[model samples]
Target: MTKDPKVVSFERTPAYLHHRAMLNRRENNTIDALELMRHAVERSPENREYRLDLAELLYEMGCHEQSNKLLLDLLAEDDGPSECYYGLALNQLGMSDVSGAMKSLKLYQKRDPNGPLLGEVARLAAELTLYESMNRPVSRRLYRATRIADRACEAMREDMPEKACRLFEKTLELASEQYEMRALYAMSLCMVGKVGEAKRNADLAAKGFPPSVRALCVCAQVYGILGEDELAFEMIRRIEDEHPYETERRLFIYTLGEMGLDERAADCARLALQETPYDRELLHVRAIAMKRAGADDRAVAGF
Candidate 1:
């Protein structure tokens, strides 16, 4: 597997960066990918392909509006009728503009009737149509918020605590009424040891938002961080009280395990297994909990 030669001309700078970023993304190193993409953009300001690719990567990375702006700029350029329309349609979809996306998608198909992206375009069109029919405005808002939150979550996973905190803060500020955004902010704050602030945000989320499963889960996390074990258990019970599905039960159990509630976590896992019997992720977490509890035999059985 010989690699492409490094770009000497600045025009190749973006491609070089993009290739490096692709390598990072393949390795699940999203932070490194983002940083490399940033460097690529900086190096090749005039290459429209580079710019478009950067925008596409950002959109995929959960920075929708930022990517939308770049895609829009590309569409506005005086190029021949090209793939820019397809990019624009995707941005429309990202913004949850089903009608607009459909309109642009039709134009893209008409312009490039045999284009390679037809299948993908059609699939997204159908998905957006269903979403628009269900709840247009809410779908749009949720999509935008999810995109922003995904980037924040990726930053957290990459161990860039401060960057994740900033992204969470900005995302929450942008969607002040969004419970999930607030919850993520709280979780990020807790990760960075700002437990007091995390608790305040969690409390605000609990009060301001409608009864959200995510908000409640976040409240559990905050309480656990603050050493309010009883409150944390109570919060976990709030979800159980709702009769969570097996998947949700696993999520709650994992949260408890992550918070170091070994006994409670193990109990939740046991109950969930009676329903699922062999859920791999749940089994894995249960093994860890059992190990923590010094139930070596039971822990080994989980494997």
Candidate 2:
């Protein structure tokens, strides 16, 4: 018997794959979406839209360098869409290349003054201008330092703690006052068995009044790693006192989980869930935290 047309096997063309990728992305299946998007791009190497879409997915996935390269290649095309410049600017920002981002933004504005992303472009431009004016002479050095720190963060995320440590050290050499970077450097140091140095950096980061949520979280992790429970708890307390935003709250919860404070993580996640009822990520985090804390029934309900 013949299968229904809808159930028949169709040729997986580039367009089909691209559409499927977008659907997967909408469903939050990012890994599968990326794979499908890659296949689409590979099959349609000459298709600018496919390439642009792939680059955008890469950018969203934190593959900044890869996305930037693709965007740059698109920008080199005489007939490329002006959107390439806007995407390039975003990737540049992700890489902490403030100057490069500014240049790309200018190009984008010149090419498409009435683009759909004009408002976003203008907002980013205004923010960058304010950032540069605030720091003035030291802005350039800070930007360079931030670029190194971004590399360090990528290394950490890739599980290359030693490389991250080296890059963070270089970042600190240029901008020692970057408490967040220092905190991350401390975490990297601890990962690489440099407990003493980690403690020193973490202590320094914690010294900043009203420490950033990232700094507090990293310092807490470093202290926990060093068996300094008191200090770790102190950092956690500070995080609670700061009235952190949603992103910071997520970080705080994850930090608690990292320090093996599952009950606290669960509690924090529950509190955050009350604030953001529809956040799938918060629900997932809360489920995991609850599971780890042995609240099996609540965990099951959460899932």
Candidate 3:
């Protein structure tokens, strides 16, 4: 039950006339927001509220130069709101003008002593403190943990298989149960040609989330990688019958292709492609199977 578009437009128009910038931001209509506020500011240059709203909108839309100028003018004429100071501070931060951002932040703190943004301000302050301390000689335990994980992720990204495996070994000493970290660690081991350990971790993850879509898909992939194609196909069949969504079916089709069963893979890929014509990966498999079957023209067209 969607609402009538006409009714929605009519309701929004009146509210926008009063709080044009705020409403435009809520709707994510940046261009119309700029237009509406731009016109209002030109017509009533004396209206500080309209000018400030326009400035905030400009800041949100990444027009920092215009936004900073408008905020400066507003601050000169009147004591602006806490949000105004915060907006200006964020704009300065984006511009890498840290000194200006600090000044604005101080002003915001003074004006909004009991404002709702106190928690966020505290979090940001903590993050800034951590960022500043990242280069210091004194090593905190949390910093060490973050660094170990960081190196592991970087090694995987850079394709340094042995380094990634060593880093993951270090990470396991800190947090063994972190799913994403464990997943990456497992993948790195696999890439470095450690099939047994990768299978062990993948099996653990599969057991942890039995019947889950992602876990099942990963298990299917792991089995295929381990040359247990029959077991992988069995898992795929179960998942497809139990969860008939496009995601499961798609994984099942890809598993067949990964196992080199071109005929059966082609059948599944054809059905999936019919329903989701724009799926690039599915199209790739279809093209591969077509080429294998000596249908070069169809494969090229599919690609």
Which prediction has the highest TM-score against the true structure?
2
> What TM-score does candidate 3 get on C-alpha atoms?
0.40
Worst 10 residues of 2 by lDDT: 275-284
Question: lDDT score, residue 30, model 2?
Answer: 86
| Tens digits of lDDT, candidate 2, 231-300 | 9999999998997766678789889899988888888878877855544566778788788888868445
Tell how far residue 50 is off in model 2, in angstroms: 20
Worst lDDT run of 10 residues, candidate 1, spans: 275-284
After best superposition, candidate 2 residue 77: deviation in angstroms?
21
What is the C-alpha local distance difference test score of each model? 0.74, 0.87, 0.69
Off by over 4 Å in 2: 1-138, 296-299
Q: Candidates 1 and 2: which is better by lDDT?
A: 2
Residue-wise C-alpha lDDT for candidate 1, range 1-303, written one tens digit per residue: 999999775555667887898798789686788788778878877677667767766666645557767777776767634566677777666555667778888877787888888787778778777876776345555667667787998998898878888887777656778776787788888888998888888877766535666677778887877888887777777776776654466567768777877887887877877754434455677777887877878456846
Which runs in model 1 stand beyond 4 Å of their true positions? 1-143, 294-303
RMSD of each: 14.1, 8.1, 13.9
RMSD of 1: 14.1
lDDT of 3 by residue, 1-303 (tens): 987666433443433563775677689887777777887777778787788788877777656767888888777765555667777877787566665776777777787878877666656655655755675435355456557878877877888979988987777676565454555666677787889898787666555544565556656677777777776776677666665456566666666666666776677778877765544567777888766666768455847
